[model samples]
Target: MNFDNLKNIYQFAEHFQKEEYWQNLFQHQSSNPLPITNSPSIKNSNIFPVCDMYQKNNYFYIDMELPGMDSNKIQVNLLDNNIIEVKGYYRSLQENCAYYLKERQNLQFIKQIALPNRVEERNLQFSYKNGIYTIYFRQN
Candidate 1:
């Protein structure tokens, strides 16, 4: 075979190998029942709230740490397919007042996450207290 033909065959084989590897990885992840932890981190630097989610029986529980946020400012929306959107604005009380030092960030942020399983839209529950937001969902 010519040099150009040989190079094309090698590239085709490499592409095929990568495709097979990715197919196997996806199959392994799907067949296993274990939860997938540690997804890619968000690129936002505005100190968005942290959240922990777990499934128990037919319900999913999500607890978020929202320090320095008021309950009235938080907004929750139940989108299609177990996706929830949490949005809120954080404004410093001393925005107008002169401050010597300021560490906290004053801005608006939104976080949206998809749950492992689908949930009943009407059965969703939410509670905010002590700088924490607890969201509960029941499976349909």
Candidate 2:
């Protein structure tokens, strides 16, 4: 066996040996979540919220960044059994405060997450704690 081939084999074996590898593979919805015929929403639609996801057993964990936003304003929905949609706007309650530097104070984000496996629409759960948004889904 050539050195390159042996390296590839060793990497494959190492990947399979780690539980995190499997978890990460399933977490991002089977390696890719690219949608066919992409659609745009809200101006500057190119910006997407940074996120982290993980899969364990049959549960999918999604951690999305949505700082300074009220939980009541956020919306989470399941579409067609595989697509997860998140929509929300952050409106500051303070009206009298004037700032010279204002950035990301008022924000809105709409993003769809695709799952490789079927999900129960009613079983989804979400929690926002300390500027982090965490959503959960179970594979069906």
Candidate 3:
């Protein structure tokens, strides 16, 4: 029919094709972790710790930046699925003081990570040292 109508049809088909391509690319596997939703603790805070994940010697390692955080304040858990969740609270030392410029504040944070492979819950371990929180998992 009209050239403009043909162009519109082409664009509509391209949009659906693009969406289908991504859906195929991101199709979830049995080992894939589910989506992460914002918890109440994270909804009001903008703090998300930087992290790195790697594998070595049949083990998966996750290292997260949590400067000035104590081991007691951090908790780690392996979900029933293949996700590892890290949760912690940070209390600002200057909470009682008012400053013209303040960047850090008391906050609760949650970070979820999908393991490269399935890991046994009993083999999960973690340690916090020198502002780095490390999680270890033996590949199953």
Candidate 4:
């Protein structure tokens, strides 16, 4: 509660507030990092949505958490047979509202996921439930 304690607390908060701090902390812990293509429309490579890719029951699935995101605003494109690009924006529930602790901000995000094998035969589908978007591919 003293001046030095308050100063130290402020310094700690300032350090965590830096974008680099969070980026380095969560720096792509996945064993296989997907290759992201640079495009003029997308910005901020740091805005990566947590994703998991796996195969089960003859289906290749990519489940990505996009909390509070509008389904209408999301776009999933098959860049190729083995690569997919997901583009979307997170919108706040209220406009011009002041937030004391806002972890999720209104920002654009583009995430590309590379599959282990090419999903030919054109059987692709997706579903969103409980803020998690699951993309399904029929394994041939």
Stretches of candidate 4 above 4 Å error? Answer: 1-43
State the lDDT of candidate 1 residue by residue for 1-140, as single tens digits.
23644565565456546665556556756565543323222224322666788888977888888776787778888788768888988666574578888866676778787777776667779888887888888766
What value of lDDT does candidate 2 attain over all alpha carbons? Answer: 0.70
- Candidate with the greatest TM-score versus the true structure: 4
> Which tens-of-lDDT digit does each residue in 45-125 have in candidate 2?
413466777898988998888777778888888898588888987565467887777655456667777777777877888
State how far residue 43 of model 2 sits from its true place (Å).
5.2
Ranking by lDDT: 3, 4, 2, 1
Residue range with the least summed lDDT across 10 consecutive positions in model 4: 34-43
Q: Per-prediction TM-score, please? A: 0.58, 0.60, 0.61, 0.63
Per-residue C-alpha lDDT of model 4 across residues 30-104, encoded as one tens digit per residue: 864543423312134433567788999989998988877877778988776677888888766576887688756
lDDT of 3 by residue, 36-123 (tens): 4232222343226668888899888888888888877798888866888889887656756868887776678887776778787789
Clashes of 3: 0
Angstrom error of the Cα, residue 100, model 3: value is 3.4
Model 1 clashing-pair count: 0
Candidate 1 runs further than 4 Å off: 1-47, 56-58
Using TM-score as the measure, name the better of candidate 1 and candidate 2: 2
